[model samples]
Target: MNHLKIRSQFKYVQHKIEAIDKESFRYNYNVIEGDALMNTLEKISYETKFVAGSDGGSICKSSSKYHAIGDIEIKEEDIKVGKEKALGLFKAVEGYLLANPDAYN
Candidate 1:
């Protein structure tokens, strides 16, 4: 597993891979600075699983879990925003994979 650190204008995030295989990937991330940290977000974890589809494609199932700092509660709207961002990233990856079929293999 590898650890990554990302820095941007709005946030500094740390990511640690929990597990990975041909069919699934799992990781946890922490917002260590900026907006999310100021807003009480502790960490976010994600698991993505891929399965073969009927028409020679793949079906992706992804889940995200958010943790708040201390006793603070995260808002539903905020979670929704996170979900949207994740979906966008997924689509971008899918597009790249589709464009270069042998890239991953």
Candidate 2:
């Protein structure tokens, strides 16, 4: 089996995204702060790539024993839509990794 994870961290005005591989214990994909990180993420094909942010914040769940991204905004009023978008985006990435395990190998 293959394990792919996406972890997100958010502060007052900043957010972070980390891509990890559980099978190989490798966590190297990091989306840094600023528009550059946004640009980098744009290059990747993920379902959540097009989620626009609202005036409020989003929520993210904490990391689990198998898969988790850390604490983030998942609530839309508090950012519920954003949370859904991020999850969708990560899910797409997970699908890609599962379909092409050799790409990581």
Judged by lDDT, which candidate is best?
Answer: 1
CA displacement after TM-score superposition, residue 9 of candidate 1 (Å):
6.4
Best by TM-score: 1
Task: Provide the clash count, candidate 1.
Answer: 0
- What TM-score, computed on C-alpha atoms, does each candidate reach? 0.71, 0.33
Query: Stretches of candidate 2 above 4 Å error?
Result: 1-78
Task: Give each model's clash number.
Answer: 0, 13
lDDT tens digits by residue: candidate 1, 63-104: 877777799988899789878876876777777767776777
Query: Residue 53 of candidate 2: its Cα lDDT?
Result: 38
| TM-score of candidate 2 on Cα atoms, chains taken together | 0.33
Writing each residue's lDDT as its tens digit, candidate 2 over 1-105 gives: 555565445332233445555554434333334442222232221112222237564332332111113443233253344446656876788678779878688
